[model samples]
Target: MTVVAPPTLAPPPPPGAYKDPKASAVASRAWRWLWLPLLILVLVIAGASVVFIVDLDSSDTGTLNPHSYRPDGGNALRVLTEQYGTPVDTPSTSADALKAGLGGDVTLLIPDTAPLSVRTIQSLKALPPSTRVVLLAPDRGALHVLFPDLDFGDFPATSPVAPNCDAPEAKAAGSIDFDGAGYLPKTIHAAHVTSCYQGGLLLVSDSTGPEFALLGDANLLTNEHLTGYGHAALGINLLSTHSRVEWLYLDQPESASSEGGDGSQALFPPWVDAASLYLILAGVLVALWQARRLGVPVPEPLPVVVRSAETVEGRARLYRRAGARKLAAESLRGGALARITPALGLGADPDPRALIIALAQRSGRTTQEIHRLLYSPPPTDDQGLLALATELDRLVDDYLTQLTIGRAGADQGNNPEGPQQ
Candidate 1:
């Protein structure tokens, strides 16, 4: 009646107890160095962030900004305009510019980088006839917004040209820089347009609307080029004509509505759409023509029975007609090796030396004879090829006969009784 104690099972060995030492060392080394790459990645991201922040801060002083002090900024021109007794109002948005223009006798300075909305265009068109509007480097889209009858013409001259026109502003600011687009009038309204600086500057004094001045280049007003030639005089003359100037300064690009009519489709020729449709249709037709397949393969019986021996003989005759003695010798030798290697218990790709040794041992032939019969150069003529084929057949037959005798002898020895005593 004694209490018996139960035997406890041994605790399981620690995890990965049987893992290979090499694999364990590799895993340990991997984990130990894992933090190095992570540290590098973090430093790279931090460095990139610092660079991006510096660039972003520098970008605030952009081109055409009236208050920007950078070389590309228009701060100098703004100071000159103010010094001429005309106060400049910096407006970053189109709405603010239009609102500023509401005051009596204000000049609206629109840079090419300013985003023009339809509402802003219409509002500018409705301004008082006395309010002057100056457009700097206006592209075709902006021109269409203001003057539907005008488009960009030939490229402007690279060198500065004289202001030969009779316009009072061009006459006063003689020999201004003209290194941008030139204008061409498309309709009868061309009569009202006065061009200066070789068509680089245009003044449209339409009796029915406000006076418009188009400056083909923005470089003329930048701080870097303001003092060059008569650029300062031209900028001050155009902008200071009114008592107040509304300068549009855009820090970032604004997204304009599609109604502004700057679509890429207008750039292509009229026949492009039709040609694209025809090409697409032709491609589809070609794909269908090539992809159509006949019905699944149909297996049929041969009309006549052909033996394997006949097939081999036919192939041999073809080789002989083609004068392929080397190829014929190779085939005969390869067939002999294929049959003998398996009977000798050698692998499909046994070493050449080992195979020659095994063949010599089994057939009682010299290694040189076996090697020559198997690995010698191909025959040069039909008679040599025939002799080589005969030798290969004899080698294969002798190997097989030796293999049969060895197996029969082993079987008799294992039978335990004397053979038919």
Candidate 2:
């Protein structure tokens, strides 16, 4: 008798507590397999990044590089020069260019003059008088250092202009594409300067010095422009004058000190830029994917509820504040007509005469009074508008009441019990 069972203490389970074991197992299996697709996506992104970095570093590509096959490169011009029976030599440094230029009768072509150092400029000044030096879009400082008698006066003309000078090269080339800086001779030495294409091309020569030719636009020699308007003839004429040509393709400015010359002065490797660009693009794609919604938007109930009477009163207040009495009267008249017309069994666009007659016969009001209430001119003042609204409400109420009474009388006549004796 003392070993009685203890009462059960757990509560009963809620309704629908059971779930499909098969479905639960399927969900768990799907979650476990999600990592396969995730791993594949990560591997694809990493592989693409590696390929992009490898491709970017695989070639020596630049704007004016003679070996670059890009549109803005000088590879086409270089090929054309070779085809025209002139030997072309690409010098990597200022020393190499100076040595090549001084070795024999060679034409030195400098596409960019920003990296030229003072020592290089001095060395160029000491070259033989027979050597021809071509400068593409040189700035004022370089021109001052190399030729003190000439400088850039104004912006160069970008449109095609006829060669207005008597130079044999300009006459042969005719109208060359002009998109470079213009040159002007110093007042004292204006006689020594020979200009063409409105000063877009200049030639400076003295009896005891090397000849200097300044081309205002460097795009004239680019592969993209070489085939356009007299560009091929102009480029060939300038660079192919001598049997040998030396092109100075300097990527960076020469360091003045010998201590920092061993390593490059760039802040980061070239692949870093490509990698950063790819990472930014990947981040954008991930953000867009994660932010995508699954289906059409679901409408939610408004947080606050507003009553119809309050809304009408608010609109009335606004109309009164704006002094729109005529508009208020028109709205009141229109609402009354719409309700009364439907009750009178009239069509949507009933004849105006028939509508007036129906309202007049039902409400015992004159046809003119019904017409005035329904279709009169709008009110001019607030008092007139209020009067119009009150009249309209009275008219609609009378018409509906008369209609109900008529229906009730007709029903009583047809009833067998005879008027609820």
What does candidate 2's lDDT look like per residue over 331-403, in tens digits?
7866887788787777776666667767777886776676667665667888888888899889888888777
Report the C-alpha lDDT of model 1 over 1-421, residue by residue, as the tens digit: 1222222323322333322223334675687689799889999999999999998787648777787788889889999989989999887567677766766588998865356655567667777777888988876766677778776777655566888788877789888666788776434273377888877888876655677888888888899999888899999999988889988876655544422344455668989999999999999999999989889999999899999999999999999999977667667876787788786667776766667767777786776677678776677888889898899889888878777777777777688575676
- C-alpha-based local distance difference test score of model 2: 0.76
Q: Which ranges of candidate 2 are over 4 A from the true structure?
A: 1-58, 156-158, 186-191, 257-421
TM-score of each: 0.47, 0.48
Locate the minimum summed-lDDT window of 10 residues in model 2: 1-10
Which candidate ranks first by lDDT, i.e. highest?
2
RMSD for all candidates, in order, please: 18.0, 22.7
Every candidate's lDDT: 0.76, 0.76
